[model samples]
Target: MKFRKATSENVQAIVEMIADDPLGSKRENYTIPLPKTYYDAFERIDADPNQELIVVENDIGQVIAVFQMTFIPYLTYQGGIRAQIEGVRVHKDHRGLGIGKTIFHWAIQRAKERNAHVLQLTTDKKRPDAIRFYESLGFNASHEGMKMHF
Candidate 1:
C-alpha cells in the first residue's frame, strides 16, 4: 500500500469508501451523482495549508483508505499545536492487514514533523472494534466526546 495526497479525481472513491460501512451508509450519499457541496469541500481542503486529505492505494492502484489530518494552532497548552485525525477508513478488503496501523504511523510521523503536541481522533461509540484498535495504537479514551449536529 502507498499513501498520497488525495486529488480532485479521488473525491468519488473517497466518498464511496466512507459510505461502505453500515453507519456511513445511513449518513453518506456516495451515489451516482453527488452534490456540488462535496466538490466544493474538497477544493477548500486542498487549498488549506493546515489540512491534509490523504488516500491509500493498493498494489493495483485502487484507492482503499482515506483520512484527513488537521493541524490546530492554539494559545493554550503553552501555545502548543495539535493534530486532529478525521474520517479514517480502510476498504473492506484491506482491513486486518495492518493497513490501519500503517496509516496511524504515517499520521503520527506527520504530526511529529509538524511539531504537534497531540494527535487525536474520535470514533463512534457503536464501533467497539475501532475503539479497541485505536487504543491498541496508543490512543487513550480519557474524555467523553460530545457534539451537536445541525
Candidate 2:
C-alpha cells in the first residue's frame, strides 16, 4: 500500500469509504453530509500550507482509505504546533490488513515533518476495538472530548 495526499479525483472513493463507516448512519446529526461538494472543499482546504488530507492506495492504484489532518500553530506551547487528525476510514475489504497502521505511521511522519509538537485524534467511546487499536499506536486516553450540536 502507498499513502499520498488526496486530490479531488479521489473524492468518490473517499466518500464511499466514509459512508461505509458505522458512524455514517448519523450523518443527519452532523452539519454536512458527505458529498462531492464537500470533497471539493476539502481539496481546496488541504491545498493550503496548514492542512493535509491523505489517502491510502492499494497496489492496484485504487484509493482504499482516507483521512484528514490539520496543523494548528500556537504561541502558548513555546511556538509549537499541534496536528489534529480526523475522518480516518479504511475500506471494508481492507480492514485487518495493517493498512490502517501504515497510513497512521505515514501521518505521524507527515506531522513530524510539519514540526507539530503533538498529534491527536478522537474516537467514539463505543468503539472499544478502535480505542484499543489507537492505544497500541501510542495514543493516550488523557482527556475528555465533547461536542455540541445545534
lDDT on C-alpha atoms for all candidate structures:
0.94, 0.83
Displacement of residue 97 (Cα, Å) in model 2 is 0.3
Q: Residue-wise lDDT of candidate 1 within 54-149, one digit each (tens)?
A: 999999999999999999999999999999999999988888899999999999999999999999999999999999999999999988999999
RMSD of each: 1.0, 3.0
Backbone clashes (count) for model 1: 0
Regions of candidate 1 where Cα sits further than 4 Å from its true position: none
lDDT of 2 by residue, 1-150 (tens): 888888877776777777675677556222244445676687687768887888888889988898989999999799999999988999898899998888789889988999898999989888899899999999998998999989
Total backbone collisions for each predicted model: 0, 0
Report how far residue 42 has shifted in candidate 1, in Å. Answer: 0.4
